[model samples]
Target: MFKSKEVEIPLRRSELISPTGIGALTTNSDGINLMPGALDMWFDNADIMENEFEIYEERLSKIFNVESFRLPPDYRAPFNKYQQAEKNLNIRIPMVRFPNWYYCSSCKTMSKEVSSRKDSILTCSHCKNNYARLIQVPLIVACEKGHLDDFPWNEWVHESLGPRCKGPLKLISTGGATLSSMKVKCTSCSGERSLRGLTTKDSEHLYDHLSKEGYYKCTGRKPWFGDRIQNEECSCIPQPILKNASNAYFSEVLNAIYLPPNRDAKIQKILDLLALPNIMENIELLKKTAPIPLIGTVLKTNFTSLSDIDNALLEDGIAKIINSEDKTENNENAVLLNLKIEEYDLLASNEKIESDFLVVQPEYDKDGNTLLHQKYGISKINLIPKLRETRVLYGFSRLNPPLPLSTNRKEIIENGKSKLFIKPQKFKWLPAYKVQGEGIYIEFDDNLLSEWESSIRNSSRVSKLNERLNNARQEGIGIKADVSPRYVMLHTLAHLFIQEIVLSCGYSSSSLKERIYVGPKENENMNGFLIYTSSGDSEGTMGGLVRLGEISSIESILEKAISKANWCSSDPVCNEIGMDFGQGRDFLNGAACHNCAYVSEISCEELNKYLDRGFVNIYDATDDFKSFFNYVETR
Candidate 1:
């Protein structure tokens, strides 16, 4: 029987519960929490995992260069007593106390153990109060080396451990009620100290007793585990932080765009055969012995019988699907090239309508007046009425930004293991969320982009972006240096288009998201980005976005989008910002700000970094050296 029934909220795999949310849900709220369990548990708990989970795993792992991605169980509505199941995928995060010290509001008595019952009623033993109101201590100390512990209240009040007198501690709050006004006192030894000036603005001098020389060191407390007493080895100085502060814990999630394995009808047919359940093991045996009539009869059960093809032909198709392979390229370029080729072929097909594979149509004609294509160096424009995007949560890091490829994987991944099972030896899979939506794809002309990359200012822009990437790598932030003039230009274009489209289209700017394709000149170079809306709602697949891509409507969109990019509300100040040293997180950008180019944090692929309006169209009409689309004459 379950201990308690907590209200479960349904959220997409993409919309993950932040680390702080996970902690608060289990500790602060009266919700039923489950532990991480076996892979089979997800199948039992979630229907989506049981049916389509493996396909996503195979596709996503290749894209992200991961071993395997575990699918999170779909959260279901609360069950009735009779419908209760044996397994629940709802995870119970490790019980790490927020304020390590819990204070009784009535008696002002401070104790580490404030909650007396499983029902979470705070009872004070000092005042003989059965139900005492407890306030969580907001003060916490965390080191850069990923260690957390309670503030040194005992040592701070006494200033030293000289007398070895065990004393009862009480936190006294005065009229002022500021941090300095609140003082800690030892009721037995009569030792008292004010908590003023303990921390500076940077939190570097967290517990300096005298002149910043004498400071408290970290004890390296790891309370997330069951033992609750293990001290990890650390050398870094700990910084005092509030429990709810943004820096306390950061959730580092890695994401990938799902690309189909094959688009050819013949290849797809062969793949369909290989995908048959319990068929791979007996594939060879069936090829050698099974006759066409028997195969036809077997096919009748799951698919339409293929009578036209002979046994020899059928065997060759199956063999081809099994042996089909491509030369392995480096992880970084390979993913972009794959997406580029897929998008290129899809758009080049020039299909006006295809109802089966969601609404997607390319607006390209040999003689049609494609305004962006002819005038602005845009190669292709394709509208997607519906698409699906998957986001997965694998592991997280606390102080240091989690690097997916960094060799120091053990320290972070183990620490962020789903608070499901206690310390599993091997971690293979992670949870994923999927959302269906619509978008527009824009591909840039290759020759024009190549010319723009040669410009001095554009090269300078790329160098700064590379520097940011290198810094992120040195700090173990798990990012690759894949910046290019083509990338920056297209990214900026996507951002500007998003802003422009929101004004004309009914969709909100926040609802649209970007998927960029950029790679080296040696390979199949990609210079494009897709801006789409992916919502969990049923109305996400509306054809409004595709209509915007139509020839009649697109000419005006391009004209307006260019006009918007040419001049920002911030104007000279925005364009004049030097990008040589960089400005954002890693000094990765130039001439871009919130008033002109910034989109919602969720909508941007680069976290709103590596964007500059100056790269798209020249901020000043006279300067064309820095701009890719600057040479376009007014039509």
Candidate 2:
């Protein structure tokens, strides 16, 4: 049986829903499409079949006018100029995102350096090369508002950014629109340039180019300049978006968070990779919050209650998994277990689904404690090209047609190659998970949401630590400051990476070493890493994390990973690259050659042909593996 009830929310929700096309709503062997009726009930509570139904349809009609996206009002202006209006509204305003030029009474040359940040004084490199004390001004701002709407920006060019680069100002913003092409002269320059952003594909590039090739008025009296480039001298103006001091690394930061949770094996690995403890802890915490569906081999096939997950958590043999983490460095980095694709797919397709096909067979750990292993093996063997994947969108609303980012007809055929759109397109929406269909509207218990929120907070402690490290790199901060938080953050991130390798990559090096963790080790594995539960009842294998001397170089390992990540993330044909773990090389060089990262492109190829191979394992009696991850920070 299924039902739904209406509830008042702070605001409406929105998403990028799949259109009624080849790749709209889809169903696999897991379950059927549960969106339409399920969502209807959650949003409406009146007589579902009678007069209430009519009213519900009317409300939904109004909401779905713009591609069925619903959203709440957004007040925060976007950092970029693209984000504007409510989340549900899709509006693209024809405007420009470029730099305007401004002339200085003193410098006389068009060489002022613009500031990228909303806050900051403009400067000049040419002048700074000589008398470095020149004051600059803001002439134009790359305003990120609801898709640039209105205005015949294609007609006239060169508008001065009035006053400081603050919004809602009296600048010649797109707020005023004209039907025909209008030529507007620059207020300060009297010179007019063509406005091509409105209709041209190169608008964004031209807009950014404004800061570099600024608009200026020439004296025409005499060619007086030190630079070699022609037409480098001008006077009249407004300025372009400034070049930020940190633009060198801005691309790197933007590249890191782009792992699509649905596609991309690397990204999928990143998300699915979770340590047993992390998975267990989160599952236990969530069980206390809502009704979860579950199935058991020896038990009955029913929806999982907290008691069921509890019994599995406490009574199952989890100790063995924990104990496996207790190996010494000499024998650590060993594979605890391995499974093929058929097994992994079972767990990968479980969320938003319910079935008995993926339940684990219960087992006992080496320590004689109970544990149950849940594994999912996602593989290419299961890719059904003919079967379209249903696209599920979240947190977007606009009033305009929510067309996919396809400017050309061919792009429609190949959605894999669409126009690039920046994320957070605007900060119009924050993330909150909600089931798509109607069933028991399992609202999060107050206590449970709070706990999950805390975990998210704790999870970010690693990011904070990284930030602190970056800050420390700069010499501005005071000396002798407490660096403990930074250390804790790093340690946590290392653990997170370990979790990623094990859970996401399915590559476990748990049997490299054996030793004592925070608590006593009841059961021992061949590796020197420890198997134990802390006083806080945190049961986990503390493999090679008791000292800094182990894993002799964390930076080297991270740097190596970054190189491969860059190649895989940026390359277009990388999708065809197979996972061939052949010979393993020293992944510690400042320059970790990508060709050397793996053994071979064919997983079954000769192991010794390359490095990091499944064959010819390090199996070193030395504690090289153990020394790598023994990242411990003493308080």
Candidate 3:
């Protein structure tokens, strides 16, 4: 039995009785369970398993198979702090966050939305069956591996993966804080920000990724990349290259690294640029606590007022004999006092008070230098706007601009095929899902679960699985990702760089640029990587002989390219990468890094052993993806 963890899932009060599966699974980690002699167990019904479960096994196995990647010089090069100092640069993978559309229990089918207090209301939408059996009850009984879809690796297939009953995906947080000290922000490209900056609206991502949370649910079942936002048209910053490099005006101290010195002013400006909550209220409170007196001397009463007071006093006695009438008009230009003092008017009457104050741009960088850039260097000004525009398209704030859903977007946001964010609180998108419900789920029966446990423990498949895992893990963000090892990556990087260089000529004959995907054929000690291209009616099938056998020389050329890039790293932001994490050696050791994006000490001998997995080995492909680029720096 999968020790089902009672997750705090949000369901409509009426959603508990639905009969359909609400998504149940067995334990997530096979390695922890069935350690010694756990394989003798057999499934009571292997026939049913073959029908629904076995179809995906072969497909999943291919993802784990090993292959080497060929990277280009820049892509294969490891970036270090000193190198990055050459250019002000930072890198983080951007992902799109989108509203999850799914079938519901209340509706008895797939649904985009249902009117309810909570999300994922499992009640029958077709009949509002208050007594419908929820999908959670028997969800785990369907499969021995305890999964609903594909990706049945060890931990996912085993029954005792962790300390909880298997719960529905998305809702369950994989407990245990593992990534210590890892700082990440909203990947959403923030647009034109006002003075104040931003925090990722989707705390869920930052929170969820931090310390797996509670129980393992699914994340990123889709390694789906967003549609390439055609950079051909986009005008990002021009990366300075090697035409005639110049440092005409600026002078440097020595080999010492430079950082944007903290001018409390700049930090203040940036902070000022961000929305600091409770500011106005704090100001109002300060005003209330301040001292401002309306004294008699300051009031400056007129002599006519004293005379009128005397006359009124004398008239009091004579008023009985003679009927006396006195009139007084309220002065429009005068300051007045009233017993209910708070109501008395003071200075002006206008909606907003106009202030006559001078605005100043505090001159200077954090360092107290004679001057930094001569003038506000707007040479790169064009770059700012283009980058901002792209962020707008991706749904991030520019710099730190606010993106309140305006009146024009109300209708579209509420009732559109796509929404910019998920519900309750909207977050950044810019990234979206290309595939849906792309994850693994599982169930368990005693006999079936027993075999599943044994298969994981005593089977020789573990070693093979590890090899496949190692291949996929080369550049892994999470579990289920096919990684590349360090050595194999160098080969891939070198190949990628060269392919790109060859492609810029625009293809005359049969030779065209082909996107490569490394996979396994029916039988071969060496894994196979397939190639596809873009000039398609043939589905991009035409390309030259795009396969790697035992090619190691590819790494050497790549390393040289990386070194050149790093040497100019001070100018281009990218060159400074690879070495920042102190893993520079590992990333730079070889001509190419493995699929893991490791470049350290890569030799031909290493790339010959491991292999690649098609295009998601994007890490290796990145090796020379920069080959198409040329940087001509101007002094």
Best by TM-score: 1
Q: Which stretches of candidate 3 lie over 4 Å from their true place?
A: 1-195, 199-476, 479-491, 494-501, 504-524, 537-577, 580-635
Cα lDDT of model 1 overall? 0.57
Least accurate 10 contiguous residues by lDDT in model 3 = 382-391
Candidate 3 lDDT by residue in tens digits, 94-127: 2221122232334323223211212222343444
Model 2, stretches more than 4 Å misplaced? 1-190, 194-310, 313-635
> Per-prediction TM-score, please?
0.71, 0.22, 0.19
* Cα lDDT tens digits for candidate 2, 1-635: 12222211122122212211111122213221101111211222232222121211121122112122222122234556575432423221111111223223244333322212122223333333433222222222221111111121221243332222222111222333331232234444444443334333345333343334443322221111111213323332222222121110010000000112233332223223223354556545544443233212222222232234333223222332333345542331121111111112222221222221111211223522211001100010111001101112321111112222212212221221111112222222111111111000001122322232243334332233334334433733222222232222222222223332333222233311111111111221111111111111112223222221112222233334323333333133321222211112211111112332232111111111112210011112122111111111100
Worst 10-residue lDDT window for candidate 1 reads 31-40
Instruction: State the C-alpha lDDT per candidate.
Output: 0.57, 0.22, 0.21
TM-score order of candidates, best first?
1, 2, 3
User: What shift in Å separates residue 478 of candidate 1 from its native position after superposition?
Assistant: 5.9
For residues 285-313, could you state the per-residue lDDT of candidate 1 as single tens digits? 55457643354345444454444444433
Candidate order by decreasing lDDT: 1, 2, 3
Model 2 score (lDDT): 0.22
